[model samples]
Target: MATIREELQAAVKKLFDDDKIDYFVGYAEDYGHTFPAILTKDSDPSRLTFDRKSYDNLANFLPELRGSRVGLICKQCEVRTLNVLAAEEQVERDKLVVVGVPCPAMLDPRKLTEGAADLDSLDESYWQEKCRRCLERNTPLADVFVGERVSTPTPAEGWPLLEEVEKMSAEERLAWWRRQMSLCIRCYACRLACPLCYCHQCFVEDNKPQWIDKSVAPENNLHYHIIRAVHLAGRCIECQECSRVCPVGIPVDVLNNVLSRDFAERFGYVSGETAETQPALTRYERDDKEDFIL
Candidate 1:
């Protein structure tokens, strides 16, 4: 009996050997950390591994590999990203071979390693918050499913963070965000880490119009984040990679999550849920609710 990792490696190797895919994207362990690895037919499949620490969205590499036949691992969130990219025609579905895995929640190494010397000492509290609320632990869109089926737990009730923020007065909320913005060092780690942010020229990098100043000031940081959030309103897949990669520990996903929730609540849209379901902001309806209109 083979483990899931073995099964995934076998699948990828088979595809590569059969010449069905030109490259493979999955997690490989090296240098004491599991990171995204690109594998070819000549690559060693034995290096591939799966664990809570395999937190990167493999789809981030898809844009760079466009037009090439690619086989890649897909967790629930990564599958959703593929769907969104497919809906936007950013990817050619025929060129992809998806090996879906039943995600068992990713770990936040920062929390689990702060006091613990070994991973086994960590408990459920170390799992990412998004995993607790995940609705798609099993991807339905895989070309081939790996591992045994695992049931996703029912998400806990209520959006506690959103509720807490909603309770803050407008001024208090503004001040709170200002403080968060001040902590940003303009590293753009959040932008670079996001799979959906594949724009060849992001607004902040444009000097022709100088859309936003290239400074580390709080105002510029706020402006950059606001523009990013607006651009991702109906497109973000809530992977939390932005928040995960922030060197300054900003909760960038909070902004994206708030917008996602609002889009779902108001427009009955959830990004990447389905290819046929039009994106909320990309389409218009005569009867669209206008309560938010000023």
Candidate 2:
């Protein structure tokens, strides 16, 4: 059995040789950090790697490279992101050749590193919380599989963090979130890292109306996060990239996760599960509850 790296190298080399794709997106190590890279025909395919340390969702780079034929190394999460992009009609599916890898989950660098250290010593305990609830270890939309299928454990209950947050009284929850929001420096790293935040003119940047305060006030930070969560309410795919990139270590995914759980419970809808499924907020039914209306 070939390792995933070898198989991906061969597959990408073939794609390049056959001129099937103009670019290949995969992971590479640089300065001891695993980051996503775009490979060309002239680039070495051996640089392509699959590891738990690889955290960037390669699909986030797709919108920038639109109109070019692309071969993407899709982990389960990236596949789900692509599905969401497809749902929003942000991408042309025919232009993409997906090379899927069964995700082994991902590790949080903050847990294993003081500044910058090798991940060789870390165990699964340091893996991201998202992996514990992952149901898509196998690529559901792979055009080609590059490795042996892997299995992941299912948690006894889902949305444990959201449940915990809900258990807090309203005032306590408000105080808790304000503490978290106060840590934000208003750097848009989360917005820049999010694939779904593809807007060319984000509301935060509008000088005409100045929708969100540009200052670093705690209230402004809370407003930004809440509005961002609302924008992604029906579309967030739980990739956790925003939380991963937050310099202040904010648990930014919690807001999105709460909405995702509500969507699942109320409408029986899961975002990014399939491209064909309509977004929960996009369509309405006559029988839908209207109790929330004033």
Candidate 3:
């Protein structure tokens, strides 16, 4: 049987030969690190590969590639992101050729030993927190699937870290967030890494309103993050890329996860499950619960 990597390379080549795509977004090995690569028709299809390290949400590259037909390798999370993007009208579904892959849970880079070899030999303990709780392993939407379907892991119970934070008193929670904010350098990697944060001008950049101060401070950082969480309340797909890219190692996704859980409980909504469902915040019913409103 052909390995998944070989299958992916062959599939991408076929897409190019079929004139189904103008560009292909996938992972390539460089300097021992697997990183996102944008391949043109002239580029070598052999460069394409997928593995645990192929953790990037490839959909993040799609908005910039608009007006061109693009093919991309998508895991379940990336598929969900595409669904959200399509529903938001940020992407033209017809212009995309989604090559779906079964995700075998990504390894947490932080937990990896130096020169870790035989990544495939590692067990579930080495997986990222999000992966442990992932409910879907196969892409829910795809133009073509390139791998055998993998068995989905039984999802772990509720978010432990979020539960820990919830247990804290109001004052303690405020202080805890302040400490996390203090470590931020305000690099905005969290926003940039997000596939949904495609706004041309984020609120912070608006000089006319000056929504957030340019200087980095705990209060200012907290304000920025709070506003960001609000914006993503009903839209965040919980890919956990924000926390993954945080230089300070702050658990940024916890805020989004909190809202995700609440939305599920209060409104029975889960973001990015399908392209047809409107975002929870985008639509309101006459019977919608407003207990959170003060």
Candidate 4:
């Protein structure tokens, strides 16, 4: 029997041989780090691999490759992202091939101790927070399935860090967020890493009315993040990439998570679950509650 990696490589090779894709986006391991790799028909498929460290949401690269037929490896979160992107008309589904893979949950690099060479020795405690709460291990949608399906874990309860913040008073929560925002260097890695933040020109770059100051102060950072959270209120898939890529470890996804939870409870909306469902904030029904509008 072929190993999972070998199977995935073979599947991708078939796509190329069938002329189904112009470009393939997947993960490649070098030294000890795994990073996203883009391959063409001429590139070696053996370079493609997936492991516990293959945590990047490959859908983030789709917009740039819009005109080309692209094939990408989709884990559960990436599958959700693809659905959201397709619904938003961001990508042409017909021009893309999705190769589904069973995710074994990515290990949190932060939790790994120094010299922790043995990944198999770690357990669920070492998994990323989003992975810990993941309800699906098998890709929900795929053009071609590559691996044996893995059983999904029971969904975890509320996000612990988000709950911890919620327990604080409004003022306390504001202060906590202020401290986190203060550490931001304004690099905007969080926005860039997001698969849904595909605006051609971000608001911060607008100088017409200057929506935000160019300074790197806490207030400016807070304003930028607040607007970002509001924009992603119904669109964020909680892949946790915003928090994962933060240089200051600000847990930026907490803001998006708060909105995701609220939308789930108040509007019964879950983003990226299906391509047919419109984003919560984009569509409004007559029955929408407006008690907080006053």
Provide the lowest-lDDT 10-residue window in model 3. 273-282
Please give, for residues 1-294, the per-residue lDDT of candidate 3 as tens digits: 999999999999999999999999999986878889999999987767898988788999999999999999988788889989998998999999989889989988888889888998889889888898787898877889988998997888799889999999999999999899999999999999999989999998898988889999999998888899888988999899999889889999999998999998999888988878787878998878888894
In candidate 3, stretches whose alpha carbon ends up further than 4 angstroms from where it belongs are none
Q: What is the C-alpha lDDT of each candidate?
A: 0.85, 0.86, 0.90, 0.90
Clashing pairs in 4: none
What's each prediction's TM-score?
A: 0.94, 0.93, 0.96, 0.96
What's the lDDT for residue 11 in model 1? 87
The number of clashing residue pairs in model 3 is: 0
Q: Write the per-residue lDDT of candidate 1 for residues 1-294, one digit (tens) a residue.
A: 889988988888789878999999999998888899998889999989877789998888999999999988888778888888888888898999988888888888667644466564456688787787787788777898888878989976556666787799999999888999999999898988899998988988899999998878888899999999999999998899998989888888888888898887887787888657666677998777898784
The residue-level lDDT of candidate 3 at 182 comes to 97
lDDT of 2 by residue, 161-268 (tens): 778888999999999999998999988999889999999899999989889778898899999999999999989988899999999999899999989988887777
Q: Which pairs of residues have clashing backbones in candidate 3?
A: none
